[model samples]
Target chain A: MSDRLPGFSTLAVHAGAQPDPTTGARATPIYQTTSFVFNDADHAASLFGLQAFGNIYTRIGNPTNAVLEERVAALEGGTAALAVASGHAAQVVVLQQLLQPGDEFIAARKLYGGSINQFTHAFKSFGWNVVWADPDDIASFERAVTPRTKAIFIESIANPAGSITDIEAISSVARKAGVPLIVDNTLASPYLIRPIDHGADIVVHSLTKFLGGHGNSLGGIIVDAGTFDWSTGGKYPMLSEPRPEYHGIRLQETFGNFAFAIACRVLGLRDLGPALSPFNAFMILTGIETLPLRMQKHCDNARAVAEFLAGHPAVASVSYAGLPSDKYNQLARKYAPKGAGAVFTFSLKGGYDAGVNLVSKLQLFSHLANVGDTRSLVIHPASTTHSQLDDAAKVKSGAGPDVVRLSIGIEDKEDLIADLEQALGA
Target chain B: MNHDAYPDNYIRGILNSVKSIAMVGASPVNVRPSYFAFKYLAQRGYDMIPINPGHVGKELLGKPFVASLRDIGRPVDMIDIFRNSSHIMPVVEEALTLDPLPKVIWMQLGARDDAAAEKAEAAGIKVVMNRCPKIEYGRLSSEISWMGVNSRTLSSKRAPAPTQGMRLSLNRMSVGGGDTAASDRAAKNKSEQS
Candidate 1:
């Protein structure tokens, strides 16, 4: 199944997912076990001490997950990848590898809720801090940086809110700061945008959503653009300095451009225990085979939905970047020229009651917590997901009580709009 | 007709009670916050029903997941919504039509909708904005245990972990979960038992 001069659909179906050599199975098989056996002792030490790259444990690597990692890296235009348990895990692992406690990182304020919580609350426990910056205003990043800052993060297309980050601007800022710029590409899912092509040093994804396409599996990946110079960074001793963990082997010296992925695998995954299951990896791969197709349809459907919601009598406003009048449309065109990703928010005229009524009434759209699925999802942020925050914090996050978010699926445009119309009682 | 009075005052009381929460966006996916929060809250013994229309009949932690709140049949005290903000109106409407309107409408960390909040508040439902129930449970319950030095109160001179003598695991003492109101309950309950 190796691709040969194939299109995205063809490559997605074939790339890195060739027929199983041992079993000759057409579909990817789940390698559901803990440890892999070594042929010999020297081979074992070579593996344990990073002398060779081979699977030691399911936590570090799995053959099934490897296919997914390789395929996503290939699709995302990166040299290598590390598949982890979830997107948040990829972020935490990347930060842990980059920072040595007391370190800071600049991040776009309009990020996914979990990432916001992780940065503000969880990571603080580890002594890692995040300074907020607007991706639209890249200079905010420079102002936030200090001697201890290790990275800058921005979403390729921020979730639920289609805010396209100017990757080139942020990447330059990261380069100036001597740190890698990590981009969360879950919403864009590689078909619509490739972060590395725009100067990103590393890219992360929550395969649970768009990348997995069908919403059946949950996975996350970290891809190395192979651009960051680990040896010269001086900030990351884990890569530049000798590794006591692996018989004092220098990661940067041993694994040239792909050193970051290796670090993520050998140290982060091994310690964090947030490894992706082989079953989930197989499911994600199956889903990605339809990534481009699904994403295009999703974008179209979302744009249509966003338009209808904006124009509807019961609706107050919409936030899709595809809409010319949208605040983010310009950035979307600049960053996501092909199309803005398929998630957006809108307000209802009746406020909270209308929002709640719409969720129960929508016959077509499913009301769920996640986005980027094949079917549309709706949520009232005020009453549900963001309710724990104070009113001030909620305002800062752009989740006011009256707003509703839609993760437009790859469904028929008319059906999506019709559902909204019916839900809105127009 | 003041919309601000929509939720009966004392939002905390509406949210606090013998509870089971059905998280609509709950996933087994580790990358998603819903998975962690669902599992964490479950570990704390809140009956969590993971309702994803995609996996309607399937189970995450072996609990039957009815697709929508409409499918859940009986009333639950709270429906902790994990969905996006734009889509909340329908869920709120469904809750309002429930046999007994849910006591509270809990939005997850990133979720908010003003119209939906106003509607819910107008219906005498308490609205808590941009917060997670799992986090509140952790902070409010004595379960937050002993957070280290940083776990001290944000403003008050008194430390939450009074003794400073005991050690705290990261999970037992977390920063976001320690709302003062919930902590007070945890303390009162503990002292009464003693």
Candidate 2:
């Protein structure tokens, strides 16, 4: 074997996977079963007591999902990872491990509409308060810190707008506050930017997006960077304190660097129970094998489309960091040098009516609520995703009435541009 | 120097070379991580000597407990420290006083002391920090995969058949007897009859 480490593309294909042990089949076979049989009573006891690592039930873990988890963890340079049902499920599992009742977590103001709703509403019920801070202003995050602050959350690339976040700057704030920096890397994916390298303690992803490439599956993952000292200050009891459910084993003390991921799996997934289907894990695994290739094409096509929209007379503004004139261009260059990702938003000169009209006139781009698919997708976020937010909140999230989000696909750039031109003209 | 990562070969070499391990801070309590590790290594055919000054006469899984490294009259191949990070320096100093110094010093998971590690390495001793021997043994032997944990090592070679009182070695090929087609067929036939 060579001393050299495997590259990103190679890891994307081969990490966390081998030929079927029994059948010798090449590709990973979906272990569709729900529970694994124990070797004996001793083996069963060992697994339940956390003395041994093995699958006991599918709700907690599965073989197919384990492969997906390891692949993402390797890609993100994380010590370990956990696969969950959806992007929202990933968020719940992650925060449940850190926050107690009445604890506060700082989150960027510019986030996905669904996330904003979840934080402001569902999380409030659980007494996990969210203090909003502007990603553009580093001081806003530092100012939001309180004695109760347990974590700082931000996205590597803001959804809808595709604006680049200053991860290192926010990470400094988290460090001073003795909190973990959690970055949602859904928009960029590991192919574009690895948040762990930028001081993120934990990275979350909606594998339903570009990682899956195809829009056929819904899955999410949490990657543990293994950087934080969870046992310090006794701030994170779920990790530092003895877990009563697992024979009073201290997760951080036993699992060490990968304890956060384990806590999420054993405590959060075990109780809350949003488990990823084995079939979805299989689909996402196949999708990830081609991530590097697909992501580059998506970026190239997106740049062409953004450029065309910027030149169009009917378009008032474009919010893609790939454009030289975009506000986040410099940060984009520093963080995601590969490309500025493929999902971005543009405003129509005629405002909301024009945005909705263009969506109807478009021939190729599918009108949907989702982003990051193999085919181009279009959505007027104000009337759809961000409709819950009032006028000022909508504009702040880069989802104004005139704003139309586009998730560029790997289709030929010229064909995409031509389709947009006809829709704008019509 | 990066204690967080060790080459697979380096870990494999240490595990294979060491025959007996004196585990500092070994507990009589069955729930403790130290007890779990001691029992596991003992089961894997290693001479596991438990050391605890507080429980000098107590035993874990039939292995007699010693007060400290000095109490072990025989030459120990390795010293597995299960103490806290701050308490490691004294333990390392004690291990160095042994007539024939241990070949390796292994710290339990979450237990790391850079200065102690440097001191041991200066004395020509191999040191592994913030890692669990039981997990490493399971991973290297491809035993962890049976429970769906990613061992992060891939191989195509067939696993050896099980024998009475089976003991898996680190050098064995990858195994997943739990998910094999033969097991699946047996399960299916049993379900059909029921």
Candidate 3:
């Protein structure tokens, strides 16, 4: 596949996906169905019981989503993929495989606000605990560890505020603990960073953002590095031990290296039922094909926007890892060498009200809670996404009262800057 | 970047697996907040030992009340306080005295005793001030599972089931045999209309 697609441009337009045979359509079709018929009762029984591998239901697997999965896996250099309902779904599914009741995992404190909620409250209800470690302080991670920890997670480039993680160092810690490293590669996209290359055993993405490109669909994906030794630990019963639901078939033993992906599909998706829509999968597949091109342009536009805000009289500070003056710039250069990504935070000199005014005034940029679209987006996170968080959590997530988050898109640089300028002026 | 000295993978596994909880100021009265709070948690399979010398040796909410933390036979994962902040230090002190201390000391809502919190914090316990686990659970997960709504659903009512006979009557309006002003106007309209 790599040989067939020699360049980013070639890969974007033609990788993993082939023309539809039945309709002769070049684009991937949306496979909208609740269930699929097996060849015979024996095949159905085999699929249901894990003796054979095929789509038993739409929630477990789909033909259209499979193309998107394979494409992202190819792009990220992973063995296999799992397409989920949302990025949050991807995280939940991954945890379901790695963690049991009373298990724990460590995550970087600097993550998306929703992730904080999921880890702190939702996962806690199930007895899965998350130990918070500062992404900047790798030692805190080691100090926080107890005997029950199962995995280490971080974002390649964190959301809202684009702070790059030292994946290599974190991966080293995970290796020492005999655990897998999971990286949320949504912000960096595969074009900006390949987490697997930095030693991340699993890569997760909210495809609704960058990979979907347009705000039309919602989806998420998880890619397995096929690197972690699941069988080594007696910890993961769903993967290492025989599953009772599947007639005692051991996923790790049967799938060999890509057992994590197989487990996510056959077990997590089968039971939990957070399956991505085929239309969403198709849209994300289309977006991913042009990821390299859009990502580069998105970076270019974002860098210009960051530079503009850094010097603006009305702006107090800008927080893009791409900015040379940024504290995380050095880390960004090492980890996400392609680009520091499109999302960033900037504070208004006039404070919170003025930030809201600027958002209301901006015409080109949509004021929604979403990021990674081809269209620029702006939001006062304190008033929206982080509103549910208490003051302590809000401050920790960097969504303070005066801070305004922007997700730069692949638009004309001058037009985007001019819009920001007009909005800031108003 | 200064790496966190602690490895992450070894830290997260045991943060929430609280095996035992010492309920400070657990109530004997069924209507009190402490009663329901203790009951919900005790129902969730946590080893809950109630503390309130007033209710000592009494079995309320299905758990026996003890005079102090020392009275409990085993170590606990957390300490859930239903008492006010001012009266917490002595309990926290006793909680700290146990060998292999509790990991979390959660102060119930309206229980903001900073002095006690600091002491617990100093003792390496994660202190969650003024938050209820039951409320957090309801907000975070679907523990209720729509069972309450489904049980009283219209179709399920008036069925030939023994449980529904009382459930249907209790769920409907209870009209007394003697008509008052409110019922007389409603009853007059009912008699004249048909």
lDDT of 3 by residue, A1-426 (tens): 011114445545554454553565667778798787777775565456543334667888886887777667657767578899999999999999999899889999889888988999999999999999988899988877788999998988986688888999988899889888999999998888888877888899999898888878999999878667676649788888877776566676454445688899878887999998988888888888778889899998999999999999999999999999999999988877778999999998999999989999999999999998989999999999888889887878789999999999888999999999999885
Selected candidate, larger TM-score, 2 vs 3: 2
Q: What's candidate 1's DockQ score?
A: 0.01
**Model 2 misplaced regions, further than 4 Å:** B1-5, B113-119, B138-194
Q: What is the lDDT of residue A52 in candidate 1?
A: 37
Error of 2 at A180 (Å): 0.7
Give the 10-residue window scoring lowest on summed lDDT in candidate 1 chain A: A1-10
Q: What lDDT is reached at residue A66 by model 1?
A: 78
Which of 1 and 3 is the better model by lDDT? 3
Which segments of candidate 1 are over 4 A away from where they belong?
Answer: A1-6, B1-194
Q: lDDT for each of the candidates?
A: 0.72, 0.85, 0.73
DockQ of each: 0.01, 0.15, 0.01
DockQ winner between 2 and 3, please give it.
Answer: 2
TM-score of 2: 0.92
- Give the 10-residue window scoring lowest on summed lDDT in candidate 3 chain A: A1-10
Minimum summed lDDT over a 10-residue window in model 2 chain A is located at A1-10
**What value does the lDDT take at residue B137 in candidate 1?**
47
